[model samples]
Target: MSDVTANEVTIRQYRPEDVKYLMEYAEENEWDLSMYDHLAYTRIDPNYLIVAADKDDVPVGFCGVSQNAPDTIYFGNFIVRKDLRKRGIGRLLWKAMLEKAGDQNIVLDGGPEMADWYITHGFPYQAYKVQFYAVKVNDEMKQNIMFKYDTKTLMESMWPDLMKYDSQVYTNFDRTRLLRAWFTGDDVRVAVAMEAGKIVGYGSIHRKPNGEYGLRNIFGDNEDVIEALLHNMLSVLPEGTVVHFMMPEDKPLPKYIQHSMKVEETAVRMFNKVKIETNNEKIWFATAHTV
Candidate 1:
């Protein structure tokens, strides 16, 4: 165990062996650890995970930041143990992360309760709204839903339509990387909804390494098409598999999902800006963490 004075915490790159301690901290805070697993975290570039430890050589907190570009860094998960709160460990971790991040703009998804914290720390409130939902998948339902779209074949043929619709929804028009990552990456499945020979909606399912599944970037102008795509994905997964989704708060999709799945979880989208420039429009939905 490495020792540091109680007045200061030691921050360092995360080692693979640190997973046990990270999981313990997450459990203590009631935060879900299913999204991150050995494979996913290991696959991430080593420079991303930053850890803060106390004099006793115990991890008090940690943060994961993804450097998408030379000018931008996206925060993934930032947390401290419940019992260690208000001890300045979290602030130390944040400061260390920002220093390592250099001049890049840092962004994160946080809850409403933490807004004041960020505001006090020098980040402006840019936007605030999102909803999370979970549903159990079953085999019988999977067999009943029709699989009308082939993701691979469409990837080759529908590039034009896909790019057009994607730009309409996102603030920025760079879906090329995201599209490739979701459709071509391992453990990810993409499906589209079609009616009368036209693409109406699409959905992608990414099964994380820890047996948990996430519904990513589902979109459609038609409500029925979105429902169909969701139902198809749910059916293909194993019975009782829990699926989670995040969508805009004002969008009708959340209410529709709640009515269909009977389960809901709410989380706010908070932001802290290293550079301050106010925008007139609120960011209702984020295209990717990089944005």
Candidate 2:
């Protein structure tokens, strides 16, 4: 274990050259780091990512905050060397990252173990955990539940209404840049529920490193729309694929989905300044880092 002193730790903006060290740290600590996530964060303004380096200029920790929207910034990628905890390295990285956002509201998706520490820094927990659920997509599920609602591929022109719907559910932070990147990614597949030519729900599946699919930002006004969006997403994929989604603990899960889905994981979603309202029923999934 490395005994990194407070004075020896330095927090600064991340650079492209630091990825190799970050990847090694992530692998060493069993963090769920992926190339897609790294690429997405890199695409953002470089100033949003802050790295904590030891006296030798080796990366020991990192924290990222995305202020794509004017009034809000979402903090993520918060990690420090396991042996370096309780030494204020995380605090230094966090405080520096927070400074990048100025007065914008800061939102964080943290773990229960670190919830109290974050609250002490002014970001309070919302009294719930983000529930992660996963299920194997077999032929029977596709046949029985996926054929109920109609859906179509989402387009760039529809971003206006989509943004409105998202704003209503998420309550803060516009995902314009982030959604644009997601919808435009070659490996990402997006589907929207359509009723009388109006979109009622939307869902997107991102290709994972292991060849499975990961659901991102699945939300709808009703079960039909939500199911339709899911069906549209799965219809294009091969059979026997595994899909994973994360939802708020309070969000209602259908009996069939609940039966088919297992609790895969959990994380605490916290925010500073004020709590944001979300439609628990409408939200079926959230991204791990971008929330």
Candidate 3:
């Protein structure tokens, strides 16, 4: 066995003061802040946020996990400050959080590099399919598109209706807290598609600090509705903004998006479940993460 130092790091619940550090860390990494809403974080009772700090009381890494239900816990964000990497801080935090999770089902998405690390640490490779779509927004297109939706209230009210469509796409349902966080973030914008006094579909647009946008959790029945929602979402962005979408490989909407935008990158969605079994039958609408 390797003689790694025992417990040189301290792991504890996140404090309100840590939000600034978290935000700064996120900004440095180009991650969407929608995953870390201050108001929603305060509402959750259990200790979902974990931070690993060194002996000097400096936070070196952080992880956020949410209990979606009694049996399911979704892992949202995990990051290690660049300068503190490879010190086993991440593994320490992971093990500590997993223990806190008990026997509940745990789900997390990691990029190619982190996916490999997760696999080495007992997170099985479950799925492999995601397409990133990007569109260059220009002044002309912005003028043509119009915004006609109330983002805040529409997003808040969308949970139930969205759950109906989401259930058709995934076997398990445990994303309420996650959705709530996404809609509550400063960077996120929500829009709905309405027809004949009825709600048809909705789209979420997440804007990054660097002028890049991410399209998330887009749900609708028809192509026209999707297009309309997309146009509406893109209308408010600044000129030359690039909007991206990470969609499932099997979804037909990718083709539609490709016809309008360029494919930037392709990646696989890999998950590791410790206790809860995943149902692969339904069409998953959005990743919990906006990457």
Q: What TM-score do all the candidates reach, one by one?
A: 0.75, 0.85, 0.74
Q: Candidate 1 on 26-72: residue-level lDDT in tens?
A: 65554434433323433444567888877655676788876544555
lDDT of each: 0.59, 0.73, 0.62
What local lDDT score does residue 162 receive in model 2, on the 0 to 100 scale? 80
List of clashing residue pairs for candidate 1:
123-273, 142-235
* Model 3, span 195-273: residue lDDT tens: 6545667777766645677777777665566667766777667877777666666666532244445354454454556
Clashes counted in candidate 1 amount to 2
Between candidates 1 and 3, which one is better according to lDDT? Answer: 3
Relative to the true structure, candidate 2 reaches a TM of 0.85
Error of 3 at 48 (Å): 2.0
Candidate 2: list runs displaced more than 4 Å: 1-3, 20-33, 125-128, 142-148, 171-173, 259-264
Runs off by more than 4 Å, candidate 3: 1-7, 34-46, 131-134, 143-160, 174-177, 185-187, 195-198, 210-213, 242-244, 250-268, 274-285
Query: Residue 59 error for model 3, in Å?
Result: 0.7
Best lDDT goes to which candidate? 2
Cα lDDT of candidate 2 equals: 0.73
